[model samples]
Target chain A: EAGVTQSPRYAVLQEGQAVSFWCDPISGHDTLYWYQQPRDQGPQLLVYFRDEAVIDNSQLPSDRFSAVRPKGTNSTLKIQSAKQGDTATYLCASRGQGSNERLFFGHGTKLSVL
Target chain B: GDQVKQSPSALSLQEGTNSALRCNFSIATTTVQWFLQNPRGSLMNLFYLVPGTKENGRLKSTFNSKESYSTLHIRDAQLEDSGTYFCAAERASSFSKLVFGQGTSLSVVP
Candidate 1:
């Protein structure tokens, strides 16, 4: 089975610039999640969606960060105005519909804001 | 609603040795998962547990919900085992929403 796929692999932007990360989840998976991992740290949940509906996004920075899963299969996360502190890796994961399902993660998009 | 605390922030072990990593939870979770983030930054699922133990090759994991702790034991460690290990928990009633730990960095030397 193909694992989750994330793109651009890496992104470098300047402060105040806008960047978007894209994700393509695995087939037959209904639950998708987005996480941010700072250097030397664990992944932190930013948002999640079940099908085309968002389940939770309380941790997302409403002012600048936005995500959408329009077709329930692919997703896009956008940062309107990047900050230097925004340098980190953005990960996308997907899993089957179950409480104990194991997560399949993508290679992640590493963003660097100068 | 709580968090996971992983122990021994970092560890170095000699190849062919055995080492154990732990995760302590402050929340009331029922399911737990362990992942290894490799040098290239890919999260590899190692084990998923529910208040019991599971073994795969030289890796074993146990989750005790009552005690709110989980452990991962690596036997005959190999150089390929160098990476960061993370444990995540999901609330009993939820649908795979995970609360993750800070992660334990492990390096197996030759």
Candidate 2:
């Protein structure tokens, strides 16, 4: 019954640098999500996947942000050429297929782009 | 415009007091979920609702899909209750996509 796990608790990089955040979702969960939370704000959806296929990513900054859940188990979100506005917490969450299943979140990776 | 709006952007409550947070959805939503983001930056699931009421310990939540709104009530608040509370909604036209409110910052002090 392990919860969603995200790696690299924190990351600091200069503008234009690249960084990647990883997430290992709970076992048996089929849906995974990535969210961005700015300081003092609620999380905003960046992307999500149902198994290995992306469900939606319209809110993502396609030019710089890319996400992959290749095997449908673990996921990675990458930011290319990070900007100061990218300084926020990246959160990973997972949910089961059941209609009533609740979403579980990870501790999140706090990113600071200077 | 915010699809999900939370009232009283910030609040302060003395320990043992009671308070409530609310979210009003401008979109057609089928379900609602509430979460507590602690100071350390961990998001904890508080309640998930589908047009009904539920209670856990000193907390209670009610979601009225017909009115497109949800509420979270905290009773006998403790210091541990200090954090930001967020409410998310699942649109009736879209499944598995959750839109979150700006959040209500709650500070419970002794």
Q: Please, what is the whole-model Cα lDDT of each candidate in the order they appear? A: 0.93, 0.95
**Candidate 2 wrongly placed segments (more than 4 Å):** none
Tens digit per residue, CA lDDT, model 1, B49-70: 9899999999999999999999
User: How many angstroms is residue A114 displaced in model 1 relative to the true structure, after the best TM-score fit?
Assistant: 0.1
Provide interface RMSD per model, one decimal: 1.0, 0.6
**Lowest summed-lDDT stretch of 10 residues in model 1 chain B?**
B90-99
| Model 1 per-residue lDDT tens digits across residues A30-101 | 989999999999999999999999998989999999999998999999999999989999999999876468
Off by over 4 Å in 1: none
DockQ of each: 0.85, 0.86
Lowest lDDT 10-residue stretch of candidate 2 chain B: B90-99
Model 2 backbone overlap count: 0
TM-score for candidate 1, residues paired by index:
0.97
With a 3 Å backbone cut-off (N, CA, C), the pairs that clash in candidate 2 are: none
